[model samples]
Target: MSKIKDTSVNFENKKNLEETCAEIYAVNLISGQWILSICYYLKQGKLRFTELKNKIPNITERMLTLQLKKMEEDKLVSRTAYAEVPLRVEYELTPIGKGLLPILAQLEQWGKLHKSMSEGSAT
Candidate 1:
């Protein structure tokens, strides 16, 4: 059996590396296969279940549901339900989720740069 590293550390004066690994935590939280895609779509605005499904054509309903549930649990997305003749539900990013947009954008820029460099070198 493998061992897990102790992550707890006193944070009274300064930040602890293990205890304050926000980047690691962020990466793990959004590391799901469909998470970034889902966040990209939701970043535009609120979307219903069907709308979200249509936006991500290849994702199965089950997978989308699961990802959404996990994101909701992580406080990244908000699920709202309305009572009406036809019940309605919408999902939108919470404040924390919105804060991730800049990071995602930076990642996208980095990916583009890497891809360009890779292709140029391969030539």
Candidate 2:
């Protein structure tokens, strides 16, 4: 995702919208191509970086690291490091992140419904 400069009009408008609407603000936090997908994978259980990468083969390692870092900063995911040979780290959803699963499920259902509706209309 591209970062909008804070001084830009678009950025200002986004800040205003987020300030006025809690839902918009929440969506903004998770508004990346990979964030939702990452969360879905994490919903299963704690996973190592490589494991998460395996689940999302299309995303670059750099992008995954950035997303994980952002999620950690946003309190959506927790990271733990183990003092083992070659070093080890695991990522898991925080309670707040777990709370998003039901919401995501609803979104999935809505997407299916919309897709079918669109296809039916096209035919």
Which candidate number would show the highest lDDT if scored against the true structure?
A: 2
Candidate 1: tens digits of C-alpha lDDT, residues 1-123? 122344534333223443478776678678866999999999999999999999999999998998999899999999999996698999999999999999999999999999999999999
Query: Candidates' TM-scores?
Result: 0.82, 0.96
Pairs clashing in candidate 2? none
lDDT of each: 0.87, 0.96
Q: Estimate the overall C-alpha local distance difference test score of candidate 1.
A: 0.87
lDDT per residue as tens, model 2, 11-122:
9999999999999999998988899999999999999999999999999999999999999999999999999998999999999999999999999999999999999999
Off by over 4 Å in 1: 1-20
Judged by TM-score, which candidate is best?
2
RMSD of each: 5.5, 0.9
